[model samples]
Target chain A: MTGNFFYFLTFLTLFAAIGVVVSKNPVYSVLFMILTFFALTGHYILLNAQFLAAVNFIVYMGAIMVLFLFVIMFLNMREDTEQHKPVLSKIAAAIAGGILFVVMIAALKDVNTQMTTTAVFDSQIGMVENLGKVLFRDYLLPFELASVLFLAAMAGAVMLGKREPGEQNRF
Target chain B: MSSASNAYFTNVFIMNDIPEVIRTIPLNYYLYFSTALFCIGIIGVLTRRNAIIIFMCIELMLNSVNLLLTAFSSYRSDPNGQIFVFFIMAVAAAEVAVGLAIIVMIYRNVRSTDINILNKLKW
Candidate 1:
């Protein structure tokens, strides 16, 4: 029952991911990305990383996606605004991505057999208490550094997003 | 094709040992799925000319990496991998904020979101 749901979720996730890539309208792309993130959250829960699942939903879908949509609306990019890439680059990009995928798959094909299936785990690693313990005790420095990074990002965003003196809204 | 994936599908089901059930689904499945998604993101990045969509593709790539980390975290029973995932998420959030800000600033200056328009910096 769970396996079936996993496959189903995978299908939806992959499909929505493609939608995000293919949709011409920026708004649709943003909406499709929300769907993709939602599916990813489900995958996180399946992996038993429940805390990350909620964080994924709140951060990616709630905060990041909303910012994307706001930018799209603020910029006022109309429908049919997508530009046509040169024909050669379009074909080349597809070929390059396909080749990379094939090569990596061939290299990693033995991974499943190579992974030792011997050890069993608690499967509760996703619980917040365990995550907090590991993060605070061992990874505390990076955790704090991430906060500094967030501050820098916030400052940079405010600075860049600010309007110059005498600049119009352009809306 | 689809048959290959379907062949690996199992009937096992459990809510308690969800990890075991998920584990039994084979490590290759997660690895391949993430790889495929990552490649799709690459294609979008390479092919699309829209700045926001390209940014979205970068997010896709970040997500694919996150999925891979979580998969390995579970397969190895290492909370460290998940910890790394949090760092990646934090970095990704920071990246999007600054990246989209740049994209918006570019759009404001040029009145267009096409990546090609930023070629004024060409030497």
Candidate 2:
């Protein structure tokens, strides 16, 4: 039953992902991406990462996607304005993606599916309590650094988004 | 092996109580799933001219990697990878903030979201 559920979730995720890329309207694309994120959250749940699942929901679907939609609506571009990349470049992109996939598979071919003998695999690693301990104890520095990155990004975004009367043509 | 012993062996000893399905799924499956998703994002990024859609593709790519990392971390019994995944999410959030701000600024100035319109940096 769980295996069947896993396959079902995978199918949903892939379908939504393709919709995100293939949709003609930007609005539809954003909606599809939201669906993909939701499916990914379900995948996280299946992996027993409950904390990450919630984070995926809030940060991804709630904040980032809402921001994307705001920008899309704010831009208010026409629905018919579909810019097509040249046919040659489109083919090149697909080829490049396929080649990359093939290369990665080949490179990882030798590594097989023997269960890791490292510490026993714990589903509880996804629990907030366990993860909080590791995050604070072992990864304290990187965790703090992430906050600094957020500060810098926030400041930069504010600076960039600021409007000035005489700075019409300034980049 | 008796069914009871098999369950005990998988749960308490080998898996440390993770779901049986997750334990049974091959690592190769995770790799394939994530790589295919990542490649799709790559193609989207390459083909899409709209900056917002391009950024969405980037987020898609980031997510594929996130999924891969978490899958590996779970099966490898390494919690550090999950921590990294958290950080990646933070960085992604920051990226979306700054990226959208830039996009908004560009749209304000050029009145178009099309990349071709912004050929000159001096404008």
Candidate 3:
């Protein structure tokens, strides 16, 4: 039953990911990327990481994808505005990626059969209460630093997006 | 291909004393799936000309990593992996904000989003 769900979600996720790549229109790509995020959220839920699932839904599908769509729309990109790379290069890229996948699979195929021995599974481990407790305890420093990173990013974005002095036209 | 993955799947899934949820799907399956997704992202990055699409593909790659981390977290019953995922998400958001701003700035200057045109730095 769960295996079926995994297969279905994996199919949805990979299909949407490919759609994001192959779609000529950036708008379509953004939409497809949203679909991919949705499937990933489903995967998170299936893994019982409900907190991360919610975060993935809110942040990736909600915030980040919307930003991508806004930029694409703001720029007013059309399907034909961007041209594809030459066939030779596209094929080369595909070949390279395929080789990478093959290499990774071959290397990690064994990867310690001892991992199957398994640890004690705590269903509550993924709950927000536990995750937050851990976040504030063991990972407190990184949590605080993440806020600092957000602040810097916000400031930098504003400065970068701001029009320069005496500029003729604005974005 | 099916036979190989099936063999690997049985190898990983059969011997585990993991809880029902974690045992339902093999850990090796997650590894293979995420690896495929990551490779797809790489292909998108290498093939696409639009800077924004390339940026999106980069996000895809980041997401694949996040998925793998979450799977490991669950299989090991560890919250620390999920905590790392939170940090990754935070950093990813910041990255997108700053990266999109940079792309916008570049677009403003060049009047185009094609990465090929911004090759003035190439020597």
The lDDT leader among the candidates is 3
Candidate 3 residues lying further than 4 Å off, grouped into runs, are A116-119, B1-21
User: Candidate 1 regions off by >4 Å?
Assistant: A112-120, B1-20, B121-123
Q: How do these models rank on lDDT, best leading?
A: 3, 1, 2
Please give the lDDT score at residue B8 for candidate 2.
25
CAPRI classification of candidate 1:
acceptable
Over the stretch A1-171, how does candidate 2's per-residue lDDT look in tens digits? 767787888889889988888887999999999999998998888888878898999999999999999888877865677677888998998899889989988877776655534445566888788889999999999989999999999999999998876775543
The ten-residue window of minimal lDDT in model 2 chain B covers: B1-10
Candidate 2 chain A: 10-residue stretch with minimal lDDT: A112-121
lDDT of 3 by residue, A41-112 (tens): 999999889899999999988999999999999999999899889999999999999999999999989885
User: In CAPRI terms, where does candidate 2 land?
Assistant: medium
Please give the fraction of native interface contacts (Cα pairs under 8 Å between A and B) kept by each candidate. 0.66, 0.63, 0.70
Tens digit of per-residue lDDT, candidate 2, span B1-123: 224223222434554366655655666778888988998899898887888888899999999999999887766666788888999999999999999999998888776777767768846
True contacts kept of 2: 0.63
Which whole-number lDDT from 0 to 100 does residue A41 have in model 2? 93
Deviating ranges (above 4 Å) for candidate 2: A167-171, B1-16, B119-123
Q: How accurate is candidate 2 locally (lDDT)?
A: 0.83
DockQ of each: 0.48, 0.53, 0.51
Write down the TM-score of every candidate. 0.90, 0.90, 0.92
Order of models, best TM-score first = 3, 1, 2
